[model samples]
Target: MTPEEFAATFERIRREVRTVIVGHETLIDHVLTAFIAGGHVLLEGVPGLGKTLLVKTLAQSLELSFSRIQFTPDLMPADIVGTNVVMQDAEGRRYFEFQRGPVFTQVLLADEVNRATPKTQSALLEAMQEHTVTAAGTSYALEEPFFVLATQNPIEMEGTYPLPEAQLDRFLFKVKAEFPTAADLVEIIDRTTVADQPQARVVASREVIRQMLRLAREVEVASHVKAYTARLVRATHPGDPRSADMARRYVRYGASPRGVQALILSAKVRALVAGRANVSLGDLKALALPSLRHRIILNFEGEAEGIDADAVIQNALDETPELEEART
Candidate 1:
């Protein structure tokens, strides 16, 4: 697909989603970016913020299999990745059979993901990273265009297991779902209370989504632009000379290499969606926060002081220059 075609299709999908979703334009954009980038998204918000509704709307707007997994403390790995079971055929022969779980679908919605125990949560690690589920020593490949959109309530920590760092790193972007404005809330109530409720129409196909992913990778990134992304990620480390003052003071660990990968790929998608043939500095800058926030580990002092990862990321962005000066 051409860049313009990609942008048009993206906008169409966004418009379709907006039909049912009241607001949260930024959240929708990040989720769509991750979808086209072939990456997963982690959405953090309180209950009743329409996080689940957003994922469902996206699924309704696309032609793909959708599955919703309501994560809970008692949820198990087998409940998520399927398990081998003994079966009897019509011929009276007994054999082992694998029952596919919700993870087998094209789009998986892990609602309140943190509510599940760590062991149960680890079940998705392999699928998210490799797109394959291994059960009873047998490997099952998930359907193509597999995307996971997980939501967790940030206000409630009781009885919830925090996602491990390794698992957290798997998500390409961690989007914060902000509450709706007064006008948006009024519109939401009107839509829900009235007899006529908005519904999202299917606007894009799996094939078109695949094409968009291909075109996004085809978007060019200049050498200096690539170097700038690398520098931005490097500056997150507290010990690195390139590290910003905020990072050195508040950050315990910097973002991983995957963070850099996410930034570049998302920026490419952002550029394509903006009808640009190549990624620009602004694209990278705009993506730095969502791409690196969850990846950065804060120090105890920073946590005690209630430091925000976004603040530290902004510091890095301010201190990191676009290019290194040439030798005199």
Candidate 2:
């Protein structure tokens, strides 16, 4: 699809989602970007913040198979990826049948994912990264357009397990849902309490979404922009000579190569939405926070001081130049 067509399609889905969701233009945009960029998203917030609702509303606006998995301490790997069952045919021959789990769907909402154990959480790693699930000595290829939009509560909350770094790395964007303003809360109550409840309508089909994903990949990236992205990622490392002062003081581990992938793909989507055929340096910079927030691990000092990841990322962005070397 052309850039204009891509933007139009994206806006159509966004408008359809807004029919039910209240204010959260930024969060909504990030989620949609991850969706079309062919990456997973982790929605983190406290309860009653509509995180789950947003995922469902977005699913409603797409013509793709959607499934919901309510994660708990008891949830298992097989529960998510499914298990083999012994089945008998009419001929009396029994064989192991692979029954696909909710992970097989195009859009999967993993609600309360932090409540699940790390082992269970790890079940989604292969699927999120390789788009395939291995079981019973066989690998099942997930269909195209597969996405895992997981909702997670803050780890400080009761009975929650912090997602491992590996799990966090699987997500392309980590969006935090802020509490609504008083005015927005009132509007929310008004809409929900009335007889005519708001609903989102389907706006894009699976093929259209696939096309957008392909188009996003085709967006040109300048060498300077690529170099800038690498420089930004490296700057997050405390051990790197070019690291930012804040990062060296506050960060223990830097973002991985996957983080760079997240920034580039999401920036491409942003570029497409802005009707641009080439990615600008600003697109990567604008996307740095969400693309790298969960990827960076804080040092003991930073953790004790309760430093926010965004702060460290901001410092890195400040330290890193848009162009590595001037051609002029």
Candidate 3:
């Protein structure tokens, strides 16, 4: 698809989702960006902030099979990824049949994912990275365009387990769903209290979404823009002498290679959504917060002081705003 057609299609999908969602334009945009990039998203928020509703609406607006798993401490790996069951055939011969779980769907909403134990959570590690599930000594390839949009309560919240760093790394963007403003809450009440409720109509089919994905990958990125993206990521590392002051003082670890991938890929999506054919420095910078937030780890001192990862990433952005020659 051409850039204009790409932008038009993206806007149409977003508009359809907006029919039910009240605000959170950026949240919706980032979710859509990750979806097109064929990457999963991790949404962090407290309950009742519409995180679940947002995921549902997105699935509804697109032509994809949708399923939801309300994760809990008792939830098991087999529950999410499915388990084999004994079955009988015509001759009374018994065989194990794999009963597919909710994870098999095209769009999966893992509500309160962190509520589940890490063992249960690890079940998704293979599926998220490899797009396949191994069960009963057999490998099952998930349907194309599979995505896991997981929502987790804040780590400090009661009964919530922090997602292991490995799982966090798998998500393309860690979007924090903030509480709505009073005005937005009023609007939300108005929308939900009425007899008629809004619903999203499908705007794009799987083929169209796949085409958009190919187009996003085709968006051009100048060498300097790429180098600049790398610089921003490097500056988040405390050990790097060139890192931002806050990073050097507060950060324990830097973003991984996947962080770089998320930034570049999401930037391309942003560029296309903005009707641009080439990715610019601004595109990468605009995405740095969500793309890098969950990837950066804080040190003891930083944690004691309650340093926000967004603050650290923003500091890095300020320190290295452009590409420069490596210092000897």
Candidate 4:
């Protein structure tokens, strides 16, 4: 699809989703960006902030099979990835059969993902990264265009197992869902209090989404723009010469290469959504936070002082020059 066509299609899907979701335009855009970039999203927010509703609405707006998994401490790996079971055929012969779990669907909603133990959460690692599940020593390839949108409550820490860094890196974007403004709250109340609830209509088909993903990959990146993305990522590392002051002082670990990959991929999607043929430095700057926030680890002092990852990323953006000449 052409860039214009891609943008139009994305806007149509967003509009359809807006029928149900209130406020948070930026959040919706990031979610859609990750979706078209063929990446998963990790949404951090308190309960009743529409995180779950957003995922469900996105599924409704797309023509794909949807599955919802309520993650809890008692949840097991087999519950998400399915398991092998013995079954009897019509011929009366008993054989081992694989029972598919919720992860087999195209769109999976892992609600309160952090509430589940790390073992149970690790079940998604293989499926998210490899797009396949191994059960009983047999591999099952998931359907094409598989997307996982996981939500976790940030305020409730008790009994919650924080997602390991490996799992966090798997998500393309870590979007923080904020509470709605007063007016938005009024609008939300109006929508929910009435008998008629808005519903999102399917605006994009699975094939169209796949095409969008392919087209996003085709978005060009100039040499300098690509280098700037790399520099930004490198600056997050404390020992790197390009490291920003805040990153050097506050960060314990820098973002991994996966973080840089997500930055470029998500920026390409952003460019396409903006009807641009190529990614610009501005695109990289705008996306740096969500793409890198969860990837950057803070040190003890930074944590004690409650340093926000977004602040560190912003400082990196401020300090990192986009052009080579400006670097000097």
Candidate 5:
């Protein structure tokens, strides 16, 4: 698909998703960015924020298999990656076969992912990064356009396990599901609390989505934009000379190279989805928080002072060059 066509496709997805989810347009945008960038998403929100509904609506709008796995503390890696099973044939010959887990689907919703143990969470990292799962000394390729939409409750929630940084890096964006405005809440109530819940129409096929992903990758990004992205990533580190005062005081460790890569890829996709042939600094700024939120580590002082990652990223944006900001 051309850039213009890709933009139109995203509009269809937005319309379809909004039918079921009343608000949270930013959340939807980040999810779309991850989709085109071939990266997974980590959704953090309280209950009743429509995170689950949004994923379901997204799956419905695309013609692909969708599976939901509710992660629990007792869940094991074998439960997610699947284990070999022994079976007997009609001729009495025995052989072991691999049974695919819920991760095999094109869109996998790992609900309350942090509730699972770290081992179970690690089982999905390979699939998210490589789009394949290794089982029983054999590698099984996942379907094209594989996406893992994992949700997590707030840290205060009991019996929850925090996702390790290594596992967190696999996700392209860590979307925060914000509450709806009063008007949106009223609309939501009118739409769902009454008789009918809005239904989504399938707007794109798996093939069409793949084509759009290619078009997003084809979006041009200038050297200035690339440099600006690198600066944003670097500013997350406390010791970096270019880091802002707030970053030096609050940050523990900066984002890795993967964070910069995710930021640029997401920016390119965002530009294409907006019908732009090239990536702009605006695209980078819009995605900076979600791209770096999971990657940046907080210092003990920052945690004690209740300094969130968003504040540090905002400060870093202020340190970015005006020439780059204007281009965005």
Candidate 6:
């Protein structure tokens, strides 16, 4: 599809989502970018902010199978990726069969994913990165357009095993779901308190989403912009001169190559959604945090100083905004 066609399809999807989802337009847009970019997303928010509802609505608005797994401490890898079992046949011979898990769906909702143990969380890493799961020395490929939308409660740390950086790196964006404004809250109440809640119509199919993904890759970017993306990610490292003293004090590790890839890809999608055929520095600036927030690793100093990964990423963006766009 052409860029305008891609934008039209996504706009319809967005309107469908807004029928039930009242607020958080930016968060919704980031999620859409990740979808078209063929990347997973990690949503951080408190309960009752409509994070789950948003993902569910997206699932409903697309022609895809949706599965939701409520992650818990006792959840196992086998519980997510399925396990092989021996079954007796009519001839009395036993045969090994695989029972596919919830991860087999095209769109997966891992609710409160941080509640699961690290081992269980790691189970999703292979699927997220390779779109396949290896079990019993056999690999099973997931469906095309497979996407994982994992949510976590930011306020709750107790009994939660934080996602290791290795697993965190698999996601494309770390979107933060914010609370609704008073007007939005009133609208939410006005809608929910009544009997009828708007339902999202299926606006796009798997083929459309796939086409959009291909179109997103064609969004042009200047060579300097590409270099700037790489430099911005590198500047998050401790010894980089562009990094602030606070970053050097607080950062344990910088983002990986995947971070730069996500930064560039998501920006491209953002530009397409805005009806642009080429990525702009403003696109990169707007997507910096969601693309790199989870990628940055904070040191002990950050923990003690009460500085979070978001702050470090924001500082990096502030430092690089001028330089990143100078070529433009």
Question: Clashing residue pairs in candidate 2, if any?
Answer: none
TM-score of each: 0.97, 0.97, 0.97, 0.97, 0.96, 0.95
For model 1, the superposed segments whose C-alpha errors exceed 4 Å read 325-328
Encode model 2's per-residue lDDT on 8-47: one tens digit a residue: 9999999898889998889999999998899999999998
Clash pairs of candidate 1? none
Would you list the rank order by TM-score, best first? Answer: 3, 1, 4, 2, 5, 6
Q: In candidate 3, what are the lDDT values of residues 1-328, reduced to their tens digit?
A: 7889899999999999888998898899999999988899999888999998998988888878899999999999999989989999999999988999999989999999999999999999999999999997899999988889999998889998889999999999999898999999999999999999998898998888889999999989988888888888889999887899999999999999999999999999999999998998888888899899999999999999999999999899889958586442
Candidate 5 — number of clashing residue pairs? Answer: 2
Model 4's TM-score against the true structure:
0.97
- Cα lDDT for residue 275, model 1? 88
Question: Residue by residue across 235-257, what tens digits does model 5's lDDT show?
Answer: 78888777877789988898889
State each model's C-alpha RMSD to the native: 1.8, 1.8, 1.2, 1.6, 2.4, 2.2
For each candidate in the order shown, give its overall lDDT on alpha carbons: 0.91, 0.92, 0.91, 0.91, 0.87, 0.88
Candidate 5 clashes between residue pairs 3 or more apart in a chain or in different chains: 281-328, 282-328
Error of 6 at 202 (Å): 0.8
Clash tally for model 1 = 0
Tens digits of per-residue lDDT, candidate 6, 1-328, equal 9888988998999888988899898888989889989999999988789988999999999978899999998999999999999999999999999999999999999999999988999999999999999989999999998999999988456767789889899999999988889999999999899987788888998888888988898889988788788778877889776666657889998888899999899999989888999988889989998999898888898988889887887787777755544321
Listed per model in order, the count of residue pairs whose N, CA or C atoms clash below 3 Å is 0, 0, 0, 0, 2, 0
Local lDDT at 156 for model 1: 51
Q: 1 or 5, which is superior by lDDT?
A: 1
Question: How far does residue 4 in candidate 6 sit from its true spot (Å)?
Answer: 0.8
- What TM value does model 2 have? 0.97
